[model samples]
Structures are given as structure tokens and as C-alpha cells.
Target chain A: MIIAERKPVDEIVEMVSGVKRVLVLGCRGCVSICSAGGEREVEILASLLRLGASKQGRTLETIEATLVRQCDREYIEGIDQWAGQYDAIVSMACGVGVNFIANLRPLDVVYPGVNTSFFGGSADQGIWTEQCAGCGNCVLHLTGGLCPVARCAKSLMNGPCGGSVGGRCEIHKEVPCIWQAIHDRLDRTGRKEDMSRIAPIRDWSAAGHGGPRKQVRDDLTV
Target chain B: MSFTPDIRVFCCHYTSQQAIAEGLAGLKNDGFPPNATIERLLCSGKLQVSTILKAFEDGADGVCVVGCPVNECHNLMGSQRAAHRVLAVRKALNELGVEGERIEMFHLPRGFHPEFVEAVKQLDERTRGMGPSPFNGGTAK
Candidate 1:
């Protein structure tokens, strides 16, 4: 799932400064699950905006709406209900949702309320960790279901880097050495032999390094 | 002329039972600030950051949250959750250039206790010094 966190309220207040009316948009997708941008967050942000505006002796009218999923075209159409009611939009969705609004509604002014962090999963309540780099490659089978590209600080393919100490990354004691965990996981599962094979050089094209990446399914396309 | 701050108090059911039982006159006799309004909640954990912000948006000069003592909450971690939510509102208030102290959280024992009144009095005093909320176009006194 895509992980994100809201930008500071001050920055958002400044973004919509002088705008009399604004739409606070939310997405019920990965961001909602991660608690970054959801219906509840939309309400919080809208209220904060109004409070901030009031503090400045300015009145800001905010319209709150949450789309089922802002990434899809049909859901993006839900925004039409609030068309012309707002002068600008404060999108609480991840970057993709913000882009979808921009791409579909070229005339609308949109501002990102949250910063898109990475493709990750909830580790616990109120906690999320990056799990996939979306490098257009799958090497989990070779690493006992762990991807070095995301978990490993250096994304090392083979063994632990010299920086690993006591099974923790040198970058931070809180970060476990992914290679160490991988080795232990493989050993416990009787698949340690998988580590014996050397991994080949990785290709970077699919990771969006060449440019924006796209996928089209001929069978599903109209 | 003295400033009477409009303080909004949100207290959980268990912790605020006594205050609710006291009736308005009894509370006034017990020194409850007349400017403060008490709202009872089933559980503090059910409180949301938006709710606290709404108080300010609705013209509250200050806000206070009273919940069961941290570990003694009837719903286990309910008060703890409320504390976290209050902290979130405090951060947001600070971000908006308002005094974070305008809102506070209190973990107190349930039933009639002087601490409950004391918490309200403290907030009332603090808010009185702060004058009306910036949202109300008043500066700190």
C-alpha cells in the first residue's frame, strides 16, 4: 500500500491563503488504511483550516468530500458533485490521487495535503514500514519473502553489508539488518541453500528511472 | 472588568459521573467555573482531534479533557487514547500559531474528587490570563 503523512498545517494554510472557498478531498484507498488521508482526516483538516483562517480574521469556507478511491476515473467523477463550489482543492490523498485530480480536471487548482512516502504496509496500529520498493522486480522468493530493495538500507543483493552490527543497521539501532533477518528466516525454513546462488546485476529501467512507467492490459482495455 | 474565558470541557462517563451527579447548582457551589461547559462522553477513546478543534472553531477560548487515570480507564486504554488525541490537537494548534496550552488533557481518578475541580480551575485561570481565543480576535492578556 502507498504510505503518506500530512504536510504541516501551517504550510497547507499558506497554500490556500486568500482562497475564500476550498474543497478538502480524501481517498479511501491505501492512505485511508494507513490513516494519512481518509474521511476522518478530511474532517480534521477542514476544521483546522477553518480554525486557522478564523485566527487570522479571515473566513475560509471548506467543503469536505471523500471519494471511494481517488486513483480510478469513476471515483474521480464523484468530485463533480462539488464542482464550482470551491476555488481550490486540498487533496488528502497520496500523490497518485492528487495527480489523478490534476490529470482529469485540468482547470481545477489542486494542492497536495500529504507527502507520498513509499510503498509500505502497516506494521502495527499507528505504525507503518516500507516493504516494497516497486522496482518492477520480484526477488522475494530468493530472499525468504523479504525484499532487500526496500528493507535493506543499501539494497544489497547478497549478504549483510559491513555496516550491519549485531543484526541492526548502522543507520539506526531501530532498523533490523534485513540481510540478517533474511539469513535467519532462510535457515529456520531449511532454505539456506538459496543464498548460495549469486544474484545477477539488477535492471533499473522498470523502476521509473527511464521516465514515468505505464502498464496497459489489452484484454481489459475498451 | 475581568475576562471570563469560554472553556469547553470534555470528560469521559466514568470520570465525570460525580460532576454530572452534582447538578449545575451543586457544581457552582463546589467552585466549578461558570464559564466552562462540561460534555460527557461514553469513552475518551472515542474522542477525535477534530472534535477538539471544533471547540475552538465554535468559539471556545480553551478546552480541557478529563478521562480516567491513565491505567485505570474502565475501557482499558481509553484515556490513553484520548491523551494521544489531545496531543494531536495541541500539535495542530501550535502549527496554526495558537498557543498549544489552550487545550490540555487530565488523567484523574473517577468519582468525586477535588482534582477534577482543580483541573478546571487551573484551565480557567490559564485561559483567563490568555484572554479570548485568537479565533475570537482577542490577544493574550
Candidate 2:
């Protein structure tokens, strides 16, 4: 799922004016999955905007609409009939959904309510950080189920940098050294022997090093 | 078609609404957009998703939760946890077909009067946009 973060309130306030009418669009996909853009966020943001704007005595009309996936045309079409009712659209989806709205309705001004981030998982309830570079390959098996390519500060394939200390990355104490974690996990799993195997040099080419790559199955699309 | 949202704001005893006599002393601020009501919990982290949804069932237009500045939380990690809960609630909002924006959790210092004032005003505006919550008059029915 696409990951995203909420935009600053000040920035969002500036995006709308003569803004009596608004449609807060929520996405039930990646942005929602990551908690960046979701139905509740849409309401919270709408409330903030409404409260702030009304304090100035300027009235704005606001409504709520959530789609399954704003990035997909089919789901986006759910809003087709209501498009004429709103003065502007505040999309609580990832950047992709926001842009998709723009593509569908060129005349309407669509504001992105969140900042899209990279593919990642929720580390816990509220915290989420980057986890994948989308290198178009999976190498978790090479390391003990750890993706050093995504976790390591250097994305080092061979071993830990000298800066790694006490099982933590020297760059930032908050970050546990990814390489150290790998070693610990390997030892715990009794697979320390895998580390001795001369890991071949990574074929960077497979990671789109040659260029942008696309996978197409003619059967999937008519 | 219109839902008057109820809002619950979680404040830190140190810096949030509790610090200002206005939040408690001024609890009488014209009530909230029909269904809107403000309740002070021990800490923003005290907020549970179930508790928040209960407010919705009782008829709330939106819910606002304010916490201590990240590390400044009196309870150490309470504010952080609250923030995370807010994120989870946002996801819940998306799934439920209701605008998640209705629920907000923010952080404030001990004397964030300016921000506090701003947040209240924002909450008011958002409720207005929602017009009138459908539960406005029917909750008792």
C-alpha cells in the first residue's frame, strides 16, 4: 500500500479560499493502511479547517466522501455524481489518489491532504518508517529474513560498518544496527553457517540498474 | 446525510486545557455543535478507541485529543501512545466510510494557549462543515 503523512495545517488552510463548500475524500487503501490518509483523518482535517476558517466568520460548506481506492478509476467513479456538489476536493488519500482525482476532474482543484511516503509497515500502532526501496527484487533469504537493503543505513550487503556499536548504529543511537540485528537473529536461529557462505556480488542490474523495468502479463489485461 | 460530529480532546494535566482555567472554567462554551461534547481524560493516552466510538454512538460530531509534547509527556510515553492511537483511529475511520478527519489528536505544551485556542476554533469550523450530525436530535429517540 502507498504510505503517506499528514500535511501541515497551515499549508492545507492556504490551499482553499472562497472555500465555503468542500468534499473531504478519504481512501480505504494504502494511505488508510498506514494511517496517513483515512476517513477519520479526513474528518479531523475538515474540522480543523472549518473551525479555523469560521473563526474569521467566513463560512465554508463541507461534506464527506470516502472511496475504496482513490487511485483506481472504478472506485473513484463513486464520486462522479457528487462532483458537481462540492466547490473543491480535499483528498485524504496518498499522493497517487490525489493526482488521480485531478486526472479525472481537470477543472476541479484537488488538494492533497497528506504527504506520500515510501512503502513500509507499521512498526507498531502509531509509528511507521521506510522499509522498502521497491528495488523490484526480494533478498530477505540472503540475510536472516532481514532486508538489509531496506534496513541498513548504508544498505550494505557484506557486513556492518565500523560505526555500528553495541548493537546500535552510531549514526543515531535510536536505530539498532541492522547488521548487528542480522547477526543476532542468525545466531538465535542456529543458522550462523549461512553467513560463512560467500555471498555473490549483488546483481544490481536486476534491481532496475539497467533502467526502469516493467512486468507485463498479456493475460492479465485485455 | 449530515452528521453532527462529537469531539473529545485529551489534554495533558501539565500543559493542556487543564493548565488553563479556561478549559475547565470555560467548559460552558455554548456546548458543542449539538452532539459535540468535551471530556477530559487522565491523559490523552487514556483515550481508548472503544471509548471514542462510544462518544460517536452517543452522538458526537468529532473527537479531538490533545497530548503533551512528545517527550514532555508527564507519563513519559503517554502522549506518544496517544498519537499512535490517533493514527489507528484514522485507519478505522477510513474503513468505516466515515470521514476520519472528524477525530483529531494533537500535542500541546503546558501553556499552548495559542495552539489550544486555534484547535478549538478549528474543531468548531469542522463541525460547521459537517452541518448537523444526523444523530443531532435522534440519539434520544
Candidate 3:
């Protein structure tokens, strides 16, 4: 799921100025799953904005709607019929959803309600951490399942460096040494033999050093 | 004479608004406070708590949402969704130090304007006694 967080409320109110009728649109996809943009959040924000606007004696007509996926056309069509009634929309989806809403209608100004963060996994509920750099390399087989590129301070490609202190990285006391974690996981899985096979000198070309990569799924598309 | 109240009401179109003429007559008795204002909505089930909250935020002493009763929604279950939302928002308002009674919901079947007006007037009195929203407390203007 796409991990995201709400931009501060003040920013959104400022962005929504001069609007009389506003739609608070939420996405039930990634952003909802992550708790950044969802039905509840939209309502909460609408309440907050209403208070702010009312304090200024400016009344605003608000409509609340949630689409299955803001990034897709079919889901957005759910609210299309009522689009003209609203002056503008505050999209609770990620950046992709924001842009998609923008492209769908020339008249409505789409404002992002959340800051799109990264492609990551939940560390736990209410907590998420970055896991992939989209580095274009699948080296997990060599270092156990843990990602060295993301967890290691140096993004080291090899075994532990001198920075390993009592099994923690030098970058921060809280971070366990990535090499140690890799070693422990390999030992637990009895895959130590897999580590003996030395990874060849790092292939910089395949690892996005060669620039953008594209893979066409012929079967899936056709 | 008992003090009448101005209850801000949002009547759903298909059911409540469709029955407004009869409802006004039904509510013309002293049961409804004189200061109340009635607003219309596409569906009471369409009323999100934010709509109610914004009303409170807009300085309405209280907000009353009248929708088709649970089983009678024009959109089939829209009222149920609104009920669920009202419950959740009540919890939120409580947490924010706002009175839960400031936001309320009721079911209105088609042709039940009398019942609808009574509900609105009663709610208005209840809220007027509670005073303006704590968030936009009276005359914070």
C-alpha cells in the first residue's frame, strides 16, 4: 500500500480559500488502507475546515464522497455526475490520485490532502518504514530477506564493516547492524551455505546506474 | 409560555423534503420553536458528520439530520451509513471536548413530515439549552 501522511490543516485551508462549495473526496485504496485518506479522515477534516471557515463567517457547502480508487477512471466516475455542484475538491488520495482528478476535469481544481511519502510497508499498525529504493536489483537471495540497501547506513553490498559495534550500526545506536541481521536470519534458516557463494563485483549497470528501466508484460496487456 | 428554539434542520430530498409542506403544517403547533431554520439535502443518508460539524462550526447552536429511517432509505442503506457515521462522529466530538448532543440524527419516512417537525423542534430546544458549539462558541466572531 502507498504510505502517506496528512499535510497540516493550515496548508489545506489556505489552499481552499475563496471556495464556497467544496467536496472532500477520499480514496478507499492505498491511502485509506494507510489511514491518511479515508472516509473518516475526510469527515474529520471537513469538520475542522468548517469550523475554520465559520469562524470567518464564511459559509461553505461541503460534499463528502469516497471513490474506490482515485487513480482509476471507473471509480472516479462514481462522483462525476455530481461534480458540477462543487466549486473545488480536496483529494485525500496520494499524488497520483490528485493528478488523476486534475486531468479528469478542467473546471475543478484538485488539491492534494495528503503528502505522498514512499513505497514502503507497515512496520506495524500506525507505523510504516521505507523498504525499497526501486533500485532494480534483486539481491535478497544473497543477504537473506532483509534489505541491505535500505537498512544499512552505507547501503553496503558486502559483509559487515568496522562500523559494526556490538551488533549495532555506527550511524545510530537504535539501528541493528544490517550485516548482523543478515547473518542471524541466514543462520536461523540454515541458509549459511547460500552466503558462501560470493556475490560478483557489484553490477552497477543493472542496478539503475544505467538509468530508467521498463518491463512490458505482453501477456497481461494483450 | 415555554421558550421556543431555533433548530437548524437538514431535510433529505427524496423523503423529508418531499414531505415538507405537510411537515410544516404538522409542526406549526407550539411544539416547534419559532427560531428554527430548515435546510434541504439530497438524502439524509448523505449527511456526513462533517456536514453537521460544519454547521456547528458555522455557529449553528445545534445540527439535526433527518433522513429516511434505517430500512427506508432512497439509496437503500444510505440512512444506515449516516447512522454509523453519526455514531463515530459523536465519539470524535466527545474526544474534542464538544457536546455530542450538538450533532444528532433521526429517521423520516416519506409522508411523515409531522413526526419530522416534532423531532426537529424538540432537537432544537435541546440544543439551544446546550448553547453554541464549543469549537465556535457563540460570538467568537
Candidate 4:
């Protein structure tokens, strides 16, 4: 899932300054799952904004709304009835959702409330780590189901460089060497034969470096 | 009617809540003002950043969250999670120009009345120094 975290309150308050009425929009997608831009986070942000404005002797009327998924037009349209009433919107969605909202409402000023972090999953309760680089490629099958592109400090293929010590990455003591983990998993599963073959140099074009990439499913498209 | 600091406290069900309800009968006599309100939650882990900010938004001068000790929570990690959330809210409060000291958390043993009351008193005094929340006039602005 896409992971994100709320930006500092000072920045958010600054974005909506001088606006009496503001809507704090939340997404129930990845941001929500990470507890960053969910309904609860939206309410918290609105309340804090109110207090921030009040300290400046200004009245800030904050409304709260959470769409099922801010990345979708159908859900983004859900706020249409009341979206125009507010002077600005504080979006608690990822960058994609924030842009989607901005595109949908070109005239309305939309501010992002979160810093979209990475495509990852929860590591533990209230802890999330990057797992996928979204490189537009999948090589999990070749590396014991772990993507080196995201976990490796250098994104090395067939790694475990001379820097790997005791299964820990030399770059940072806290991080486990992804290559070491890959080797262990393969050895345990008796896929040792796969480890001997070196992986080919990666093609960068598929990773969206060429430009913004999009997918169209001819079978599903209208 | 006077400008007494209103302290809103959220107590975890297993420990602090039972402490206040069953053990601390003289809590009110021990410097707990009439404006101090106690709310019980099934687990302090359920506490969210919104809840603490809402208390201040609703005119609380200060807020305290009482949770179980580390590694001893009924839900195993509920208290630990609450501790982290409290710190996050404190950072938010500081950024919002409110004194981050307005909120605090304590790990109290189940039914430990003296410690609970002492924690409240300390927060109460700190809040008194901070004065009433700027967000409140007749109502939260």
C-alpha cells in the first residue's frame, strides 16, 4: 500500500491562512490504512488548525470529509455538494490523490496535508517500512520474494556486497542486508541453484524514468 | 465559574480507570478541581491524536492520558502505542502555538491512587501556569 504521513501543522496552517472556511479532506485508501490521512486524522488536523488560527485571533471554520478513495473521480466527486463552500481544501491523501483533487477542481486551492512516503506495508503496529520501489518491475521470484530495489541501500541485484557484515547492512547498523536475507530464504527453501545465476542489468525505462507512465486495459476501458 | 483550569483525563480501563473509580475515593479532596473530568477507555491504545486535540478544542485547559506500564498492558502493547501517540500530539500542539506541556502521559499501576492523583496535580499546576487555552472564550473559537 502507499504509505504517507501528515505534514507539520505549521506548514498546513500556513497554506490555508486568511481563509475563514476550510475543508480537511481525507482518503480511506493507503493513507487511511497507515493512519496518516484517515477520517480520524482529518478530524485531528481540523481541530489543530482551528486552534492554530484561534491563536492568531482569527476564526477558522473547518469542515471534515473523508472520501472512500481520493484517487478515484467517483469518490472525489462525493464532496462536490459542499466543496465549493470552503475557500481552500487540505487534502490528507497521497500525492496522487492530492493531484487528482486538484485536477478535478482547477479553481479551488488544494493543499496536501501529508508527505507521501513510499509504497510499503506495516512492519509492526504503527510502524511502516518501504518494501517496493514501484520500479515498474517485479523481480521477487528471483530473489526469495524480497525486492532488492527497495530494501537494498544501493538497490543492488545479486548483492551481499563486501559491506554486508553478520547479515546487517554496513550502510546502517539497524538495517538487515536484503541480500543476506535473500540468501537465507533461498537456502532454507533449497533453491540454492537460483542463487548461483547472476541477474542481468536492469532496464530503467520500465521504471517510469522516461516520463509519467500510465496503463490502459482495453478489455476494461469504456 | 472562575477561571479554573479544566483538565481532561483519559484512563485506560484495566489500570487507571479502576484506580480512580475504586481506590481513589478522596481524589476530589486531593486538589482535583471540580472541572477535572475523567473518561475511561477500554485501552489507552484506542486513544488517538484527534481525541487529545478535541479535548483542547472543546475547552480543556490541559489533558492527561493514564496508561498501563510498558510490556504489562492488558493488550500487550496498548500503553506503548498510547505513549507514542501522546508524543505526536504534543509535537502537533507545540506547532499550533499551544504549549506542548498542556498534555502528558503516565504509566500507573492498577489502582495506584496516590500516583494517579499526583500525576493529575502536577499537570494541573503546569496548566495553571499556561493559563486558559487561547482557543476558549465563552466557547472554543
Residue pair clashes in candidate 3:
B6-B35, B6-B36
Q: Which one wins on TM-score?
A: 1
What DockQ values do the models have? 0.90, 0.06, 0.19, 0.60
Q: What is the TM-score of chain B alone in each candidate?
A: 0.96, 0.74, 0.78, 0.86
* lDDT tens digits by residue: candidate 4, A1-222: 999999999889898887999989999888999999999899889988998887677889988999899888898888787955899889999999889988888888889999999999899988999999999889999998998999999999878899999999999999999999999999999999989989998898989999999999999999
In model 1, which regions exceed 4 Å deviation? none
Question: What is the per-residue lDDT of model 3 for residues A1-222, given as tens digits with 9 covering 90 to 100?
Answer: 788887766577777778988899999988888988999888877776666565455777778788889988777767677757888899999998988888877677889989999778888866888776667777887888788887788888877789899999999988889889898899899998866676677666766777767678988885
RMSD of 1: 1.3
**Ten consecutive residues with minimal summed lDDT in candidate 1 chain B?**
B132-141
Clashing pairs in 1: none
Model 3, B40-118: lDDT tens per residue?
Answer: 8777667766666656655566667777878878889787777777776676555444567766788877764467767
User: How many steric clashes between backbone atoms does each model show?
Assistant: 0, 38, 2, 0
- Which candidate tops DockQ? 1
Of models 2 and 4, which has the larger lDDT?
4
- lDDT agreement with native, every candidate: 0.91, 0.71, 0.74, 0.86
Which digits, one per residue and each the tens of the lDDT, describe model 1 over residues B1-141? 688889999999988887888987888898999989999999989888888988898889999999998999999999999999999998988888888899999999998888888899999999888888988998634
Mind giving the per-residue lDDT tens digits that candidate 2 earns over B1-141? Answer: 744345555566665543356544353463323333456666777776556655654556667777888989888888888888777666644543346676777788865366665665587687657654333432110
RMSD of each: 1.3, 11.3, 10.2, 3.5
How well does each candidate reproduce the native contacts, as fnat?
Answer: 0.91, 0.00, 0.38, 0.78
Model 1's interface RMSD: 0.6
